[model samples]
Target: MSSTLLEVTRAAHEEVERLERIIVKDLQNEPATNKDRLFQSHRVRNMIETIMSTTHKLVEIYEDKDSARKDEIAALGGQTATGTNVFSAFYDRLKEIREYHRRHPAARVVDANEEHEALLKEEPVIEFTGEEAFGKYLDMHELYNQFINSKFGVPIEYSAYLDVFSQPHSIPRKLKLTRQYREYMENLLEHLIYFFQRTEPLQDLDRIFSKVTAEFEEQWENDNVQGWEKDVKESGQLPPQHTVIDLDYYSTVEELMEVGPDKLKEALVALGLKSGGTLQQRAERLFLTKDTPLEKLDKKHFAKRSHGSEQNGGAPALKEVDNSKEIALMEAKMKKLCDLLSETIVQTKENVVKKQALTYDEMEAEREEEEMQADTESDDEEQQIYNPLKLPMGWDGKPIPYWLYKLHGLGQEFKCEICGNYSYWGRRAFERHFKEWRHQHGMRCLGIPNTKNFNEITSIEEAKELWKKIQERQGLNKWRPDLEEEYEDREGNIYNKKTYTDLQRQGLI
Candidate 1:
């Protein structure tokens, strides 16, 4: 499509030049009538030149407008047509000009009427030397630099190589997406090299060139195979094969493509592989037979004959038996073995019978004995009921029956210092009473510190009152401090060697 358009554009230029030649010829053939004729000839030449220049300029502008329209459409998130107000204004102006011309008729004079004027005004001609033209193109070149910098994060000079050397001046028409885009990629390589020389890590530029060239070729071909614009519109993302690795891994073609043959070898070595044997070979050697080196048979088959052998067809092998005198010896051994077996059988039977019978006998004996013991205990308890000992301490220090003492395990020997007769229970009961009022008062009267008292508690209220008094008098607070600290310390020391040794010796620590 572009080639055809270029051909048409070239033909149009030729036709315009041909038409200019015909007009110049017609003007030159006119009768030369002194000053007027000379002036008319000059004007005709000027008009022809003006028309040619203006026509070319208009073509350039329209082409640029078309390109800008496409760009605007693309930039506005891909609408099909550009929605530029300039196009509407141009259309309205074109209509007005055509209407004015149609309404106001002029004399039919060939290249002589001043009223039928040329649409173009004379433009200032900038006479550019080679350097200036190069500079003009360089303006485009710099844009290429900016483009490469923006798109691929490369600098302009580095991206200028292609423009400077590969194909100078005549930028490829295919890449001329727009006037900007045409120069943009054309000078990409050169500008890229410019920036890379200063900012780049050490690398062979030629290798980078080769890789990039290959990439460009690939991308170009891909765009051809799958239309670049269509692919972008159809897919929200770039295609899978279009992926480029980041800077860190973009060292070589292989690395960029992730075809890590060298790395695979290194990985195999890291996996403890030495020889270049295939995985299948390794697995076969590890899991399969190990007979002869060639056959690699298993060891289990050595003790048994192989199947389908005539001599050992159905059965493998049977043990050999002796005859005559050896048989008589075997008979004697059998008799001894049978006798031992009989003894073992008898012992097993006896063990089972004993196990079963012993539990039944024990249960029966325990029942009879428990009944006798219960009767005996009842007789003894009745005797003790009438012969109760006197309790020295009671709730009010009155004499109490010894039965409570027997059950409570507290008597005169267990009397609290604070409340002497009040202590008549176990250690826990004594400790409870110690935290009571009577026990506190008795200890104080006896010149013994209240701390020495125990078992004077007759009620929960008395225990609380004594505890509060002790806390106030002795500055003691926090119950079970000793027990708590002992527990914490012992728990902390459990992992110590001495603690472990003591635990092992005592079967507990």
Candidate 2:
């Protein structure tokens, strides 16, 4: 569309030039002398012809200059009629600009206004030039970045960026968002891999980003997937990873009896065992599958068998399992593996569908269990939370170490009298609290403007006194022209304008 518009604009220029030439020719050939020949004088005709010729020359010159300009524009990639603003190269220029300035301390940085004025005067001036930060790399190569950005086609709107680059952690500019800019930190890291790929000098950085992003992906999976499996095992829903390490060893009746009742039931379900009764019954039910090695245990339940299952498919191979947790997490793992085997048994042996009715009591118990787990973790940090000052606990439900508390100046107390003697912990908090709701409310109650002058002044008396002094100063500084201006009498005695006026009216100087 822009190309079409540009072509039309070019053609319009040609048409206009052609029309102008035709109009000039018509005027010149119209003959200055009329049909009556009343103005047919040699000198007059010569004067009229000279004026028309000069006008024709001026028009030709304009056309030539315009053509030259068109060629220049075409050489630099023909002008696009659709361009609303200039595309600045931010990423390509900012680093170089900073480097140049840093290396050359004597180099003066010319601001935008100075550069504009110098250009207007056609004088040479060093101007700050940088390429605009356009996130084409993210929009193209990074899949997540591309996907998130595709949700909104508005890259920039209302004079603000509406894309991923406008997000909180955007490298270019981190400004308050006028619209929702949803994205994850890892996506930004992935996009940086290619962002630096374009920079020849930063090839090492390209490799670094690739390594970092890979590590991030692995860490995320470990945290989420493994954490979920651990939760399932803890809840007695599945057996732990290590216990399931050797499904064949636990197939015997003796091994089956070793697991607890709940685990035994779960094991029965996992091994495709459908029988249900006491703990011993569930165990005895699992013992029936002793001959069918863990490898072929599923064959009795299902007639069809895959070639791989018949060969190496005894169980799914786990990846990245930390086997070192075998001892400490044995009970959990035992329950986990048994539960998995139990599930396999029931699912394969029983055609009846299993249903789970929601248990509100169990949900409450689980919530309490999670809290208790956190409490247990806290206990590991210390036998008990010991703080004579009663410092606040961190998110982990344990008081922060004493050294850290002192480092943040949390040991020192600050009382804001204006805020009803509300206590604030640390200088930073004390400084910030002045602008917060409590302090603002206090200032409002005192009928004082929440100005910067009253920031450190917390006491009610001090604030009231300052307000009184401010009022007095303002009154003294108020515009009173009658008292401020002086009038000199004939005897050179000076009086205030108001008194002088009164005395003069009474004919007394």
Candidate 3:
């Protein structure tokens, strides 16, 4: 037993090490800026810490049990627990090494270009042929691949999309566009499909449904017992009081057909949609029936059953006209909706392109100015003052610029006071940080009294003040109930209390 436990413990330790390698490699591509790097480091720390803690607990339990079992084994025979002792000793040393590594900071992380530069120094370059549009396709493919790769830690290679486009089903049929457009569309679809496949698993859907039911049952078992009992009493498991018909009779098509059209007509007559005229006259009346009720026959069911009436050879002309008009009206509404949606999409795309063009111009201008400054500085030794503007602090003797301090403050201003990180990427991140915090804290603090300018923070002082206020409000060290209550209110307002509260305090809520 001791030896078996030792082997299991060793295996678990090895497994965690393997998992850690994968996690670290995945995070290598993340940006190494103040907030982003801080966040990535924190995330990696959390993952490693979790792995370490779990490993520790498992080792501790195994050792305790193994020692007791060894004593039992000693009583039984002369054989010693060498394997158990060796594994325990090894795990202890490994844990100590890991702890030391945790205490000592690692080398600073660098950007993707820097990392790629280091890699490309040894590797030979490959060449490819391309048309004019091929460049655009390649660019789009690379961008899409990068986005997915960074996000999900999944490799969606350019070759994979090329393979997809080469498939007979896609190339000769649906995506029969120019080669460049086909490849681009394939790449886009590849990303969408990859994400969808990752999210949607192949396990029995009923199992998920069962788990949901089990969770609901577990949650409501104690607290809602009396209510549940009352509900069961009021609504018994037997057939509903309104369900008077025999279910067995309705189960088979043969049984329904055996009832005959005459019997069905008589049943409908009993329900008050009968005409004073004969069966032919009633069929004619029912054809045009819209608001008329046949108590047990739903209007939808009546319309469906009326399809059989067409074969019965009555009111064929009336039925054809009704179906045609309904189809025509539906087609007209669909066309109008399509036009409206297309117009909205065109305007939205125009706005986005305009905004992107302006941003690109600004970035280009800044780059040119930076290049000019760099050239001038290289020419003159006196003006060698490195503008450590957006650079990380503690790089050189040059003191950290005022803007970085301001940016850090702005990043903090938007970061979750509870989580100490940005909520998500893109839109959700913006909504949580800028709209939620800045709006609540007072728009004047962000210097955007009326406008929605979240990306731009006005000054270093305002940013610093906001950051300080957030810390105070969150009661990081100081336990202020008033501020805590404010956090609670904001959490509720955003419909995200669980996200706002830490895990330890989550149970209390």
Could you list the CA RMSD of all candidates, in the order they appear? 44.2, 37.1, 37.3
lDDT of 3 at 467: 63
Q: Give one digit per residue, the lDDT tens place, for model 2 in 115-217.
A: 4333232311211113212211113223334434542333433112212332322221111111222232334334333333332221344354455456545
Model 1 is weakest, by summed lDDT over 10 consecutive residues, at 316-325
Give the poorly placed runs of model 2, Cα more than 4 Å off.
1-389, 479-509
* Per-structure clash totals for the candidates: 31, 28, 0
Model 3, range 308-426, lDDT digits (tens) per residue?
55477747536643443333232223233223234433443454455456764366446546754575568565565554344333475443444443444432334333223334333
Instruction: Score each candidate by Cα lDDT.
Output: 0.41, 0.49, 0.42
Task: Indicate which candidate wins on TM-score.
Answer: 2
The residue-level lDDT of candidate 1 at 180 comes to: 46
Q: Cα deviation in Å at residue 178, candidate 2? A: 90
TM-score of every model? 0.17, 0.20, 0.20
Q: Higher-TM-score candidate among 1 and 2?
A: 2
Rank ordering of all candidates by lDDT, starting from the highest: 2, 3, 1
